[model samples]
Structures are given as structure tokens and as C-alpha cells.
Target: MPAKWVRTFAERRPGVDVELVDCAAAEAAALVRSGTVDAALGRPGVNAEPDLALIRLYDEVPVVVVPKGHVLTAADELTCADLADESCLLPLDDVLGWDARPGTQLSHRPETTADAVELVAAGLGVLVVPMSLARLHHRRDLTFRPLVDGPAAPVGLWWSEPTSELVDEFIGVLRGRKAGSSRGTREPVAKRSAKEKAAARRERLEAAGKVPPRKPKGAGEPGARRRRGGR
Candidate 1:
């Protein structure tokens, strides 16, 4: 979605070169702060530097991934206690900051979420992660169910403070603002035609007893009957 947003906004404003950079969350934030990149898109966790600003983009709920025939498949959401006796496949370096639950059994830590996902596919153990990661590493033999009591990860856009024109334009796009307009721009007031003015005058005249008011059309009226039959 981030890539798509960049592409759409760039197309709307030609001559702007929008580059997509893939890096660790912290590194991405650093690059944005250093002006190496115009803006960074990732989870929110950056040191509060003087020249940086962060704006939230979206949030994703954490979930548990299990084998197709696992017992947890029958549940809509599972608590940490639900997996008390089960061996969980935990990643050594999880960005979600997940720690082992009290008294829960854990399998040997894998190097990455991809490794944990592969282990889960092999029926080794269950794995927990954000819904986006589950979808990212979706396998035919595995399925995911939300972890009811789990924490959510917030995704956001970060840029250097005292933004440039290009960065400001990109921020506007991310915030769903239109070009050449202020944030939360309102629709233009519509002009009333001469016929509408005449109609309004006629209604005012009728209201003042200068002319008899016409009866409002009911469902049985000719126009209403025609509309119903057309449908």
C-alpha cells in the first residue's frame, strides 16, 4: 500500500522522483532524519532527534499462525494461556518486541520470522506475529488466527523537521490532502442557477399567501408511479 500510494501521488505530480527504500525500521528513520531519503515508512520506534518528525500511518493487530489442522484453528482468537502446553516458534530478532509468556513452553529460537513460519509449516510449533507478516509469509499448509490479548503494532511515516516542498507534498498525499490546497480543504460553494432562484421566489410567494401552494406528490402520483415502474 505504501508503494502504491507513492506511485499514485507521483503520477499526479510529474517530475518528482519517488524512491522506495527497504531497510530496518531504525535505519529507515535515521535515513529520513539525515535527509538521505525524503520520508520513511515503517513501524514507529525512533530516537527523538531534534530534526525529525513522525506521523502515524496505520496500525496492525498481532496474530498467531498455526498449521492447517491445529487445535487453535477452531478458535477466532486465542490467549497466551491457550498455548500454555504448546511449543511456540519464537524468532530471535522480532521487531514486535514479543517476550515469552509466563510458564509457556517455547521451542528453540529461529533467526527470523521466515524461519519460524517455515517451522510452523513443518508442524514444529505455532508462531505469533502481526497480521501483515502472516499475510506476507502465507503458506498453503498454514493459517493464522488473531491473538485476542496481544498488542498491536503501529505503522507510520517519518520525515525530517522543517520539511521541504517535496516532503510537504508527500506528507499531504499521505494525509489524503489534495495538491494546491490546504489540509482538510472544503468543497467549493455551488452557484445557484436562474431557474433555481425563480423556483425559490415562487415558493416564498406561495408561503406568503400570494399564490395557492401546490400539493406535494405522493407515491400514487404520476411521476412517482413512472419512477417505480422504471425501476
Candidate 2:
């Protein structure tokens, strides 16, 4: 999805050279705040930080990748209960924050999801991750199934709130809001109302002596001035 966003952004902004930086979801906000990168795409809720403005792109469906011909593949989808007996291979960089204990927790944790995938291939345990990551590290012996009750990994475009025009353009691009005249777009001029237009026309006519001057309200009307009789 990040790749797709980058390609689309490049097509829309031909001049801009979008560079993809690989960092864990936890570290993306810090990298952006430190000015190492102009912007980043990560799970905003998972990596919430103060003063960082974010635009949510989309949510990634969670899937558990297991070895080919695994017994769990019987169902079209599985919940936390179905995974109770399996040893879930959890990496240090795991993004899915499950409230319920998912499967059997391993005593040793893998350093990364890629490492966990290797362990899964070696029949160590199953690894639950975003569908994107499953496809990313796809292998002939591995397959994934949707974990229906799992939390989604929401994608977001994050940067400093008061960012440069280029960064704002990228934000709009990710949001599908602009093709051109991107951010800081000028507001459309409002058309004059019928009453206002008529008033202006009457004023122009009166100024040119084309119509009689408007007179003050008579004494019968509300807020009318009383006559002094001496003047």
C-alpha cells in the first residue's frame, strides 16, 4: 500500500522525488520529529505522538501466516479462540496489540517479523500480521488466512503540523483530495446576493441622478425622528 501511494504521488507530482524509508511502526513518529524524513506512513494510533499531524490512509486487515497444509486452514476466517492451541510466533516488532492472549506465547521472541516468518517456515509457530506484510514475505511453503477478530493496522501519512508546501501536497495526494492547486488552496469568491445586487444598482442610479434620492422614514414608522417645528 505504501508502494502504491508512493507511485501515485509521483505520478501526480512529477517533479517531486518521493523516497521510501523503512522503519518500524513504533519508530516512524520519532524519525519524522527528528527531521530525518519529511513525512512517514505508519499506524497513527499505535504510534501517537504530540505535535505530529497525521492523515489516516487506510486500515490493513490482519492475517495469520502459517506453513502449507496447516490444520487451521479449515475455516475461512479464525478468531482468537481458534488460535488457542497454536504457538503464535511473536516478533519484537509485532504491531498487532491483542487484548486476549492469542494462541500459545513462545518463550523466545524473534527480533523481527521476517525472522518470525523464518521460524514459522521451520514449523516453530504461526505468525499473525497485516495482509500487506504477509504478501511482502510470501514464500512457496507459507500461506495466510484472515484473523477476523484481530485488530487492523491503520496506515496514516504523518508529518509536522506546520509543514512545507511540498509535504502538504503529498498529504493531499495520499488523501486523493488534489490533482493540482493542492494545499493552501484559495477559497472561491462568493457571488453577490439578489438583494445586495439590487441595492447596489439602485445606489449607482441615484448617484448618477437617474432615480429619486431615498428619503427618511415618516413619523408613523418605527424609530422615526420627531419634528422640532422651530426648524
Candidate 3:
């Protein structure tokens, strides 16, 4: 989605370029706060640091990942209490921060999500994570079912003070604003005159090869002298 938005922004502002910087969920807010990145896409709980502007995007659904043939797999969805007897491996860096984590606590928590997922795959425990994370480290031997009663992760756009035009432009794209919309453009282009509209359309057509290059004024008129005729 960010890539698509970048492309759209480039098409409108041809001189501007967007670069995505990868950061851990725990560090995303600090990266933006310290001016290391123009903006970040993350959830509010971890990425919404104080004084940073945030625009909530959407709610991310929660899911529980379990090995194949796990009893939870037999059901389409699960609740926290359903896995009370199972061991839950909680990474130290868990971003979701579920107030009600499922299952029993692990004897030793993993250090990161990848490690926890590995433990889950090894049948040491099951993990409750966002559906996106579950899909990120997907394995053929593992599958996830929705956690019907879990907290929904609220994802958002985070940026620090003195936001740039490019950041605002990307925000508009995420908000579904058209290129010519007032939020994106200083003035709407929809009210352009017919002549202005026709000229722009011709330029676009010429660029796209949908129409022949326009002839120079009077170049083919009957009385006009050809460039190389009778030479």
C-alpha cells in the first residue's frame, strides 16, 4: 500500500521521491520522533509517542498461530480462555500488549517475535499475534485462527513535528484523496477551462501513445511549403 502511494505521489510530484525505512515496531516512534524518518506506519500503542502527530488508519485483527492438528485448529476461531491449558510464549518485544494473553505462561519468554514463532513451530507453545505478523512468518506446518475476543490493534500513520509536503501528500493518498482533490492539491483542477482541459488531455494522450504526435501549426496546410519538398 505504501509503495502504491509512493508511485501515485511520484506521478503527481515528479521531482519528489519517497524512501521507506524499516524499523522495529518498538523503535518506529523513536525513529520518527528523532527526525530519522519522515513518517512511519505502525500501531498507536507502540508507535504513538508523545508530541508526534498520528492518523489512525485501521484496526488490525488478532489471530492465534498453532501447529497443524492443534486442537484450536479444529475450530474456526478462539477466545482467551479456550487455550488456558496450553503454554503461551510471549516475546519480550511483543507489540500487541494484550491485556488478556491466552494460555499459561512460558517458563522462559523468547526475545523476539521470530524466536517466538520458531518456538511455536517447534511445538513449545502457541502465539497470539496480529494476523499480519502471522502471515509474515507463515509456514506450511503452521496455521492461524482468528481470536474472536482479542483486542484489535489500531494501526496509524505517525510523524513528528514540522511535517513535509510529501508526508502530507502520502497521508492524502491513504485517506483516499484524488490527485486533484483539495486536500492534496492547493486548488482543485476540476474547474479548469475546456481549452486547458483539452490541451492537458492531448499531452497525456501523446505521452501514452494513444494519439499521434500533434502536427506543428500549419505544417500540413495545402499552401504551406514542405520542409524538404523539391529540394
Candidate 4:
């Protein structure tokens, strides 16, 4: 979803170049705090600094990645109980806290989720992770199924003080706010009701000089200029 937003932002802001920085989820907050990046997309539930601003994006559910043709694939989804008999590989970076112990635990946990996924592909064991991570490290030999009872992963946008217009624009886009809406320049005033229609007509007449115009502010003052500006 952020990628899609980036594309839209780029079109609207053609001169601005957006660079994506890849880092461990644990490092995201620090990177933002240190000013290494203008903003960071921090992992869910990671308490941010008091000075930082946070906007919650969405929650991603946990899923299990298993080797192709595994019996668990027969079901559309699975619960922790259903996976109790299998060997579950818990990656070092695993985020979800399971309600039920998944399966016989592997003696050695993989160093990373990607490695855990490789092990799953090799038929060594199953790996559980957030749906986004599973898709990120997707393998042709492996497939995923949503874990119905697993914990959710909430993601958010983080930024520091003295925010820029670019950050405001991105936030607006993320929240589905139309461009220029903040400046009262995009949407026309609703004229559905008779009262509203009459007001709108009066405004049009004023704009067109059909009605008597009010005195311009400071018209008789020395060196007073009209309001001329572009947004």
C-alpha cells in the first residue's frame, strides 16, 4: 500500500525523488530519530520517542509458510491447534506472540525469517510470520496460509519535529485526503439544499459584480497591494 502511495505521490510531485531505504524493522525507529531518513515506516507496537509523531497505518495478520503440497495446504486457514503436531521454526525476528504453542519446537531457530522460509521449503519445518513478510520472502516451493488466532502486526508512519510540507503531503495521501483540500481550494461548496443553493448563487453574483461590491481592504491607504498568490 505504501508503494502504491509512493507511485501516486511521484506523479503529483514529479520533481521529488523518493528513495526507499531497506533496514531491519528494529532499526527503523533509530534511523528516523538519527535523521538518517526524513521519515520511517516503523513496525507496529514499537513505542516511539516522545518527540516523534506517529500515524498508525494498518494491521497485518500472521500466516504460516509451509512447503508446497503440505497437508496443511488442504485447509483454507489453520489455527494454532491444527499445527500442534508439526515442527515450527521460529525465526529470530518473529513478531507474533502465539496463544497456543504452535508445534514441536525446532532445536535451532533460524537467524532470520528468510532463512526460516528456506528451511520450510526444504521440508525441515514450518515457519510462522506476518503475512507481509511471508509474501516478501515468497518462494515457488512454498505457500502461506493465514493463522486465524495469531497476533496482529500493526504498522505506522513515524516522523520528527519541524515537519516539512512533503511529510504533510504524504500523510494526506495515506489518509485518503484529496490534494488541495487543506487549503480550501479543491472541493466546491455543496449546493444541494435550497438555502445552500441560494447562498451559492449570491456568492456567484458577488464574484461577477452583479451585486454591489464591498470596499477593498486599505484601498485608500498608501502602497496597498491586492492579494495575488499561487498555492
Candidate 5:
């Protein structure tokens, strides 16, 4: 979604300069607070902070990555109890943060999700994470299934409050606002002229691959109203 929003922002503001910063999920809010970045797409954690605005983007479903032919794969989905006997490898950057983590806990924690996935492929243990992360470090020897009882990974767009116009424009893009949408504008919509409204409507229709509906027969002609009787 971030990539899509970036493309949308670029297409909308072709003359504006754009840059993307890659950072740890937990550090996204800090980056915004420190003004190191204008905005960031990060996992939820910014609500308690002041002078910050965040828009919840999405909730990623949790999945467990396992080696191919694992017994857990026999079933479509596994519950916490299903993993009771198997080792569960939690990476240092684990996002789920499940309090009552399913499966047996191992002393050795992988440094990152990719390493956890490698261990799973080696039959060392199963690793649970958001579906997107599993897909990120995908391997041929590994497969994943939805962890039905697992927690969701909620992500959002984080930025400082009282944003500048440029940051607001990017925020609008992340919020799926139309290119011409007036964000936080106090002007009344009546400010637009009838011709301008019509043109805008036409543009929207064109973008949607729709043709404007034709007027009823003689509808705009003077005295063209249909008679009540057959006469």
C-alpha cells in the first residue's frame, strides 16, 4: 500500500521531489517525532504521543511459516494449541507481540524474520509473523498458513501534527484522496462555478471509463413537457 500511495503521490504531484526512508517498524514514529522524516508508514504505537498525527492504514493477518510437509500443514489452519509441542522461534524484530505465544519457546532467538524463516526451513522451529513479512522473506522450502488465533499487525501513516502543505499532500495520497481534493480547506464547495463543476464531473467520469448520460428526449427544449393524455 505504501508503494501504491507513493506512485499515486508522484503521479499527482509530478513536480514535487519525493524520497523514501527505510527503517525499523518500531522506529517509524520516532523518525517522524525527530523530524528525520516528514512521514512514515509504521505499525501502530503513536497514539499516546502529542504533536503527532497518524492514520491507521491496514491490519495484516498473522501467519506461521513452516517447512514443507510439516504436520501442521495437514490442517488448513492451526490454533495456539496445535503448536504446543513444536518449538516457536521469535525473531528480535517480531511484530505480533503475542502475550500468550503458542508453541514451545526456544532459548535462541533469530536476529530477524528472514533468519527465523531459515530456521523453520531447517526444521529447527516454526515462526509466526504478519503475512506480509512471511511473503517478504519467502523461500522455496517454506510455506505458511494463516494463524487464526494470532493478533493482527496494524499499520498506519505517521507524521507530526500541524503539517506543511507538502506533508499534507502526501498524507492525502496515503488516505486515497483524489488528486484535486481540497484537504482541510475551509472554503465552501459553492465557491466553484457551474462550468467548473461540470468539467470536474466529466473528468471523474472519464477516469472511471464512463460516458455522461444523455438527456431525456427534448428535455431541455422549451414547452417540451409530455402531455398527460394521448392527445
Candidate 6:
């Protein structure tokens, strides 16, 4: 979506390219510090590199995933105590802090959010994770409910102190800033007027031999005489 936004924004300006990279939070921060990548996106507070600047993008609430017919399916929000007797499936990395559950019996530890979701669908146990991860690994037979008092995960955009214009443009888009916002280094291209667009279309058609050449206008009609002389 960021790349798509960059492309749309660049349509009028031209000469812009957006590249997407995937790596661990630490690795991404290292890339930014080394100037390999202009910017990086990752979980907030995950990378504390000295030279990298972190910009908070948004916060995601943690949630609990259960099977469709499970007793908690109708719940709007769940608490850690609500899962006391239930076996909770947690990811191996524990990045979302699922292991920090106050009083729950963890029956299994899956390697990834995807694995946890699958376990939940198979009735192995319930899984606690960030709302985005739950949605990412959503299963047809499984549903999620927000954890009212659970930890909130913050997502952030990171970049070196001195970033390039292109990186700034991407950051602006991620922050939902307008095209002309100062936070974005690249200016939006001015839209062509209807008359100007039609004139350009006619020129293209004429060049393609699908339309006749337009008649020259009067000398006083702007630069018509100069254009005619050049032709």
C-alpha cells in the first residue's frame, strides 16, 4: 500500500521508485544506520540504535483468538483470567508478550503466529496476539476478541538522522499526511487542466497519424506564430 501510494503520488511528478524490504527489526535498524536503506518500519521500542530516529505510526491492541463455536466467541473483550483454565498457544519468539500472561496454563508454544492460529482452529488452545497478527493469520473457523487490559503494541517508522527526499516522501504517506505537507519532501504534481489534457491527447493522436494536423492560430494567439515558424 505504501508503494502504491508512492506511485500514485509520483504520477504527476515522475521519476520516483519505491522499494519494499523485509527483515528483522534489528537488521532493519542496522540497514538504516549503514545507509543501505533510507527508512525502515518495525515494532516500536524494539530497536534502540543510537543513530536511528523512530517515529510512532500507530498502536495495535492485543487480542485473543478462539474457535468459532468456542464459549468466548461472543465476547467483545477478554481478560487474562478468562483464559485461566484454557490452554493458551503462544508464539516461539514471544515478541507480543504473550508469555507475560498473568495466570494462564500455556499448553503449547507455536513457532509463529500462523502456527498459533492453526492450533487455535484445531481446538488445541487459545492464542493471544496483537490484533494485526490475528487478522493476518485469520482462519475461517476462528475468531478474535480484543483484550481490554492487554499490552498495546506500537508500530513505528525508523530512519537515519539524514534521510533522502524519497524516504521522507514515504514517511509522509505512512503518517497519513497530505500530498503538500511539509513533512513530505516530494511535492505533488499539479493536475492538468481539462483543456491542457485534451490538447495533449490531440497532439498524440496527430503524431500517431490518427488525426489531421490542427490549423495555425492568429499571431496574437499566444505563441502560435512562433510554434508555426518552428514547424
Name the top lDDT candidate: 3
List clashing residue pairs in candidate 5: none
Q: What TM-score number comes out for model 2?
A: 0.74
Expressed as tens digits, the lDDT of each residue in 1-231 for candidate 2 is 668767877776677798888887788888998999999877765656667887777899999899989998887898878898999888888877655658889999999999999999999999999998899889999999999888888888779868887777667767776554425233434568999999999999999999998886553566565678845
Q: Rank the candidates by TM-score, best first.
A: 3, 5, 4, 2, 1, 6
Candidate 1 segments whose C-alpha is farther than 4 A from its true place? 45-51, 99-107, 183-231
Clashing pairs in 4: none
C-alpha lDDT score of every prediction, in listed order: 0.76, 0.82, 0.84, 0.81, 0.81, 0.73
Runs in model 2 deviating more than 4 A are 180-231
Output the number of the TM-score-best candidate: 3
Flag clash pairs in model 6.
none
What does each candidate score in C-alpha RMSD?
12.9, 9.3, 8.8, 11.2, 8.6, 9.3
Residue 152's lDDT in candidate 3: 89
lDDT of 5 by residue, 1-231 (tens): 777777887786677768888888878778888899999877773234455677888899989899889998998997888889989998888877777897788999999887888888889999988898989889988899898887888888878878898788788777777665677232323368899999789888877879855566656877776788857
| Candidate 4 Cα misplacement greater than 4 A, ranges | 46-51, 97-100, 183-231
Which segments of candidate 6 are over 4 A away from where they belong?
A: 1-13, 23-27, 31-36, 105-108, 175-177, 181-231
Q: Which stretches of candidate 5 lie over 4 Å from their true place?
A: 45-51, 184-231
53-169 per-residue lDDT for model 1 (tens digits): 778887788888899989889988888788887787768756676555523446588988899999888888888788988998899999999887777777888777777766776
lDDT of 4 by residue, 1-231 (tens): 768988878866778888888888878888888999988887756454567788889989889899889999999999989888999998777666454567898989898888898899889999888898999998898999999887778888888877677877777777777655552223434437988888789889999989986667656766564577833
Give the clashing pairs for model 3: none
Please report, as a residue range, the 10-residue window in candidate 6 with the lowest summed lDDT.
Answer: 218-227
What is candidate 3's lDDT per residue for 1-231, written digit by digit as tens? 678878888887888768888778888888887788888888786544778888888888889999999988989989888888999988988878876676788889899988999999999999988898899889999999998888888888888767676678778888889888876975666688999999999999999999999889756768676576666
Worst 10-residue stretch by lDDT in candidate 1? 180-189
lDDT of 6 at 197: 100
